[model samples]
Target: MIGPRERVPQAGRRGTRMAEHTGPGRSAVVIGGGLAGMLAVTALRGHFDVVTVVERDRYPADRTFRKGVPQARHLHILLSGGQRALERLLPGTVAALTEAGARRLYLPRDLLTRTPTGWQRRFDERRHPTLSVTRPVLDAVVRERALGAAAGPATRVEVLEATEAVGLTGDARRVTGVTVRARNGDRGAASRVLPADLVVDASGRGSRTPQWYAELGREAPQEVTVDSGLAYATRMYRPTARGEAPDAGVNVPGWPECPRGAAYVPVEDGNWLLTLSGVRGHHPPTDEAEFTAFSATIGDPYVHELLARAEPVSPVHGFRDTCNRRRHYERPGGVPDGFLVLGDANCTFNPVYGQGMSVAALGAVALRDTLDAAGGPGPGVLARAQRAVGRAAEPAWIAAVGADRPYVRGGGAKAGLGERLTTWYLDRLTARAAVDRVVGAAFRDVFCLTAPPSRLMAPRVVLRTVLLPRRPGLPRPPTAVEPA
Candidate 1:
């Protein structure tokens, strides 16, 4: 039997090509042209006759930081799951990233992380590997691939720059379009309305989707926020001949005691993207002197050493808007029929976990499946898509909240006795992960987004955790040694 799919509307802009509209033939309007919006377009490409991406900022071709995405200046890595999804949507996308200087580095082996447990030991290559590069470069590549996939002569993909989506155009039962306002030349000016079969809000953390839905007489989605007031400071450095290794990249994990994190991701053109982050009550310094000193406190000296040697290529860019916020769009009676939310608009994660981009990519994959199930962008499409996307987002939410709660100052309700027991047992599992290959692989599966967190408590994995030694097994932080 054919899986559930959206039924196409009989009268719509892209309705003439009914055969091509196996999912939805009606027009699709996507607000925001970031990575999530682009990938969402790819997911709905064949299903829609006309796909319009509306953006507040004009997109540029070159790999440089721009407005709308202030977080673009920092070091970003695409988890293995996201890499595979992009490849599935647009073939050779990962290769393109590598060609553009993003390293497809293996985890554990290619990574050097100082965890709360201990320094993670070097291990053999696993099933999944992460892609490391500048956020702008990664976005440029994905944007190019997505535009190529969605744009065509007949089934065209249109992008409206300098346009703002202020309100929904449809009623409470079904959304028909949007009320948009383009930026004025200097001051006050009237905006225009754009109609469509479907409207997707990928407008980042600042999205007004909750208010928009309420104004449409729809119920508001339940909000869950875990904010540690995290702050990130990043600067680019020119990579050196000795440190530019194709095999490994430097990483430093955050701890509960320290609540600060750092990373040195190898990017293209012999460059390294350096980032330092601190949680609530322990903010990282943005100035050159303080930035270097902040790196010294992260329980390691490698990042500090590198910062002292590499030439600074960019000014220190700082961001404190990082928070873990989610809208419960999946719950019953939560979403409307004609509108759906994706990416940071739907949920925002702490950037230190590096889960936002990957989760957004996963949401796009779910978008493809949802469109296929619905048969097109039908009136019932919004609610169904919300549930599907929510399911796809579960893994990342669990991993991020679970690991982050311990570090954040009162980020989560105190762990119950059961939770404390579970935490203690899992600590042993993670301790084993520092040395045991099998345990490391199992843990890495969840940590790398290749598997679910449930795997950590599986029967065999739990038994391993129970059998492992009580004492932590990894080495202490590496210290400077005398020259030969």
Candidate 2:
């Protein structure tokens, strides 16, 4: 229960007295203790005296399942772009994950991917690196490092587990803090407010920032949702040894022609994380028999063949909330001072693309950069930070939304002439990449987020795309034994 002294009046409405923190603050409160929340706290530590992360679930002592992050059961790969951002933010995060048994894969070279167009030919020396680890291992290592950094001099970082934020405590003009309640729901569960000079909502896809805004008497940020109706079912397996093992990683793309896709990724402990997926009416089933059959429906059958006899470490896990949901938090005057949103809360992409955590890391970098340029945390700084974060996520959003629009239901914005032309061009480029190293290198850069989408539009790439005849694709997955 909150003491009477702790309760403060909301900032009220626009015409009323506002509670704007015109300068840097002593404390900040971050809602959600997931990756985004922890990184948010890290971003604020240099600018604030104290920071606190509130999470609804108790922190697991080991890398095991927790109620909060149900989607951890699926496959996740850290793109090189995300790796660079996180390494910059937390320094040596990439090495740490590698040391934890994560597979450090070089793109295309180590991957036996089957793109929608065809099999992607491997190169000998591409440097686009990706990390594959179980979600629990990734999250635990990040948590440990962030908490350790907080314990250092100059700032205080704390965590309050089993606490759920119920509402915002301020008005439309400016946000002051968050109102919260214990998750245990004990009989004496009186609510309390966590005061702050700034508040960040990094609560993932289930975020309540909109409701909190409405409670503050402000208009909710406009939203855009493009759901492809994709459902994913993943199972963990202690893969077979040596010559019989599947490729390091594989992805069968999903499009209208074949709405089913699957991926086999190597994760911690030499176990393989395989996910079977189907879109719209073809959602994958969780039953073991049905799951195996669904894998066969994908463009390729190698994933199915690999999993048909694997020993299971866990039952099939399903996640269905795959949508490109972006809240327009950067709209002029639409966002309140001292309030900002990032991570999946601000924009959630179709998880099939594995962009959520990576985008979150990029958003934290954007937040840190914006705050540093603004000199510190204050009223206008959060607004600017929100806009910058949105920009940071824009590229990934464009890639996911554009790629997914064709598979989504309902009336979405029709593809413009430019979009249709670009799609046609990319189809050829992907085909050309099957045998051309130059095209493959450029494609890998953009796909891995190391380069912008505009990289594909460069004059040299454009000339090659238009002039070079695409070589016929390999007849099958490029997993044949490499020459000695």
Candidate 3:
């Protein structure tokens, strides 16, 4: 357990009180050891002398599953914004992903997508790139990069595996540290408090920090949610030795009226990661034949076609807990000093948008940028961090929930005049993007988080949306290729 005596400065500083806490000049403790936790530690390293990452599971050295992360079996892709932020955190991180067999795919051109409007035309090239890799491989690479960077000459990143954070240790003024329980080989448990100047909760969707805040005499934060009732089923397939395999994966889009969607992405080891998903009543099945039959119903047949040539490596895996959830940390009365939430703890997306990892990376970048401006961690740090997480995640929440509402149950929002007008303009923009490469690229940029939603409102793009030639909606597959 870490205590006040363990708070000595690393190499660069000489201090007594300065080494005691992260505020002004001190150390930080981050709860959770997944990608978000590791990223948060990397971000806090420069400002804090000692950074500790605590997790309930023992982190593995390879690309394998552990108790805490269940989403590893499904399909996940990181957008360009996430890649760029991670690269900045650990200089050669992207290169490391490539070395570990991640597929670095160019947008639109490499993506064969069937949108509700029609088959999207492939563009020539792109300024932004998205990454395709299994969840475990991606997590492992990020953990390695961040943990390495956190161990720099003047900073320290300590990992406490097989440990769980019980609650916050401070009162209303600020969070001093976290109380944790560690399990030994003898099945014995020991509890203690690890003091710090700053504490970050990156414990993901199951976080109990709200209760901790209430314990400290603070009100709970406000929250908003759009539960689309999304469910996902995934299967992995390896390439056959007899035929040459293509590098690109296929996507079959859902109907504006229906809720089903499918995507096949190529990842490491010459394997294809396929996911079939639906909302509410149209949920995909787990049976092998039924799963394949469901894939045939997508707008694009390419996913079904590819399944014919590939062989399944694993049984179908499914998840149904995806919901668009957000906590309004920026609002008044609740937020405390020395403590902040990052990644899924602050906001969780529908996941179909593939924004979770990227948003986490953006959150880490925001934390770093905020720290740089403020000089060091202090009373206002958590507030500023809340703003940063909000800025990083709000656009994604809007974009995902915006498109998703028309199809899911209770899709309509508090339909004010401004909301109605904005929705109308966005619908027109989506219709135009079906045929225009320039418009498509711009739209893809926003989807990938390389740019903001306001970029679509620029005069050039707005003119294109207003006076552009209309085209048929996205195309359906030529024929329904029944999966084998």
Candidate 4:
């Protein structure tokens, strides 16, 4: 248990100078120890004298799955945009991930995507490189790096494992601290309040910040959700022989016409993860035989053909909490001073888009940059940081909502002229991207988070997408990477 006086002893030199300039006695409390929580600590390290992390689960000793993160068993990719942000926050992290057996897959070049129109041409521009690694490996490496950085001379960082944050200590005007209790199943264990100058909520999708706000007599932030009733199942496989697997991973995404999709991607240890997804009535099955059969129903048969040559090494696992939810914390009076919501706690996207982890990294970069600009924790620093976080999420949110709006039952609400026009242009652009390298590079740039979505609206891209004829991609999946 971490009390006001208790401090974890560790040593490092990364954030020493930054701590020297911080105001004495300033402290911060972060609620959660996952990637977001750790990154929040990274962003807060030099800004505070003491930083404490309250986590509900005990981390595993090795790079293995833990019960706290249920979605770890599925496929996860770190987009190029996220990769750069993560490296910025913790230098050399991308290299560390690659050294830990994570495969680097260049966008379009290393991934075979079946767009709504047809198979996307594999462009070897090598502009966007994504990291494909198991969630456990990714989490473990990040945890090790963050904890190391936290041990600097200026800020003292401590993590209380098997502990949960229950409520806030302050009222609606400003957040002052957090109330936490041990998770050891001791009914008589008393709760304690850890006072702080700032508090951050990075508790992911199951966050209880709203309830905490309500307890403080403040209205919770307004939330908007667009759920496509998406559900997915995953299973692990290994090729029967070495080098038998394809050089590139497979992606067959669902379209309005065909609402079933699948992705077979390579992970660490030469293992492959095959995830199948569908909306509402077309949810994929978890049964071994049914899971294999459903693969044949996606937009293309390439993924199914690959599945036939591999041997299953794990039982099928299913997950269904895929929804696009955003809490409007940037709105006026939405959050109190000295309090912030970040990562999935503020905005969660449909997992099929593979944007969550990347967005989290980008949000951390925004937080760090905002703090540096503000110089220190001043009167309106946290609020400004929160708004910066919201801005970081906007591009991903727009992309997700646009992609998912069509799948919503009854088409949800009627779109206005601007939205309808944008949708029409995007549909045509998607078709052009499948065959046009210039348009495809622009599309990947935006989607990978390396550039703003405005890149897609550039005159060159717009003219090509709007003026050129739509050409079909390769009728079948390419057996080898095509030269640029």
Q: Point to the candidate with the largest lDDT.
A: 4
Question: How good is model 4 by TM-score?
Answer: 0.94
TM-score of each: 0.89, 0.91, 0.89, 0.94
Candidate closer to the true structure by TM-score (higher is better), 1 or 2: 2
How good is model 2 by TM-score? 0.91
List model 3 lDDT by residue over 339-453, tens digit each. 8889998888888889998999999889888887887775676688778878889788878767666555654345456445666777778777766776776788888888998
Question: What's model 4's lDDT at 121?
Answer: 82
After the best TM-score superposition of candidate 4, give how far the Cα of residue 223 lies from its true spot, in angstroms: 1.0
Q: lDDT value for candidate 1?
A: 0.75
* Residues 1-484 of candidate 2: C-alpha lDDT, one tens digit per residue: 1112112111111111123333345788889888899788767756876677778887665667778988888898988888988987899878888988889878776777776667767666446788899888888777767666655455666677788888988888988888988877685788899998888998999999888888899988988887888999998887655555665688786767888989888887778888888898889999987887788889888787877557778888888988889998977875787788989999998888878888899999999998888878755788889888998888788777777767766665556676666667777777776667777778777767778889888888888888987667666888653321
List ranges where model 1 is wrong by over 4 Å: 1-25, 152-154, 240-247, 410-426, 471-484
C-alpha lDDT score of every prediction, in listed order: 0.75, 0.78, 0.77, 0.85
1-484 per-residue lDDT for model 1 (tens digits)? 0111111111112221222333335788999888888888888777777877887776553577778898888888888878877887878889988988888767776667676666777766567688888887888778777776565433566777777788888877778888877764545768677888888898888899888888988777888876767899998887555744334567776666777888887777778888898887778888988888889998677778766667788889899988788898878877666678898988888888788888888888888887778876666666787888888788887666666556656645555565456556566777787766677788878776778778887777777778756555356433321111
**How would you order the candidates by lDDT, starting with the best?**
4, 2, 3, 1
Q: Could you tell me which 10 consecutive residues in candidate 3 have the lowest summed lDDT?
A: 1-10
Over 4 Å off, model 2: 1-25, 241-243, 413-422, 480-484
**What would the per-residue lDDT of candidate 4 be over residues 1-484, giving only the tens digit for each residue?**
1111112221211221233434577899889888899899899877888888888887765678878789999999999999999998999889989988898999798999888777888878899888999998998888778777776777877787888899998988988899998888897879999998999999999999999999998998998888889999999999989878989998888988999999999998899999999999899999999999999998888898888789999999999999989999988787898899889999999999899999998898899899989987888888888889999999998778777877877644455575566667778888898888889888888888888888989999999999998887788886666676
